[model samples]
Target: MADGTRIVDLEAVPEDGSYRLTAEDPFGNETELILVRCDGEPGVRAWSNTCPHESQSLDVGDGAAIRDGAIVCPRHGSHFDACSGECDDGPAAGTTLPGVDLAVADGAVHLADDRYAFLHEGGIDDDEPGSTSHLSL
Candidate 1:
């Protein structure tokens, strides 16, 4: 967590499939990131936790829909690749979620890029509905 990048304890996330991460930094705003780990893959990935369609928090309800190896948005049933952030289905079909760059070291996940080191990327309201949050993409 050098440079004050928020760090998440990797061991705290489930290795099964997908999970939500509300990444926060004391000196920065909170960003909702989704933690993903697919079968046969050895590491964890963090994604912006917003459903690009409505800019709704992807983890707002019942967690991410993990089916057929993609993370489904709970709000509008949008699908995104667990590892690639590719929009596999739904409204934003051909688009990819803006990936939150991450690094793993000493059993933790840290921000890989300082540009998005803060949670206020693209001026998107991470918790609002009908927001143009995909500007980060």
Candidate 2:
């Protein structure tokens, strides 16, 4: 609603998964964000896609496993609250995922943080077919 870059339709985000998008900071660093339907007023929230425990991505294309309102880390299984991005029951407990500002209005999701500009509709490595994993597999 504030003339920010529109990222996606609100309904496009799967109820069980997240919508991935990339954004560039004012300094020109790109970061991936994961969007999920939240449980309250704004109805949507976003966090940097990295898990605090091992820096593993929360969503790996198919979607981050959402269970009981938390986004499960694909590598270590830590659960970050989809709404608050806080972890309270895993090795990543006491840590919070970095949040990316978002706004929902008129059935669309917009990049509301002035610090970031929307780059594209996927992760940083989406254009390349190489492994983003640290392990050489």
lDDT of each: 0.64, 0.84
Per-model TM-score versus the true fold: 0.66, 0.89
Question: Tens digits of per-residue lDDT for model 2 on 1-137?
Answer: 54688988999888988988888898999888889989975788989889988889887766779999999998778888889998998789999999888888899998899989988887787754223344445
Q: Which structure among the candidates has the greatest TM-score? A: 2
Rate residue 94 of model 2 by lDDT.
Answer: 92
Stretches of candidate 2 above 4 Å error?
Answer: 128-137
Worst 10 residues of 1 by lDDT: 121-130
Residue 36, candidate 1: alpha-carbon lDDT: 74
Q: Quote the lDDT for 28 in model 1.
A: 64
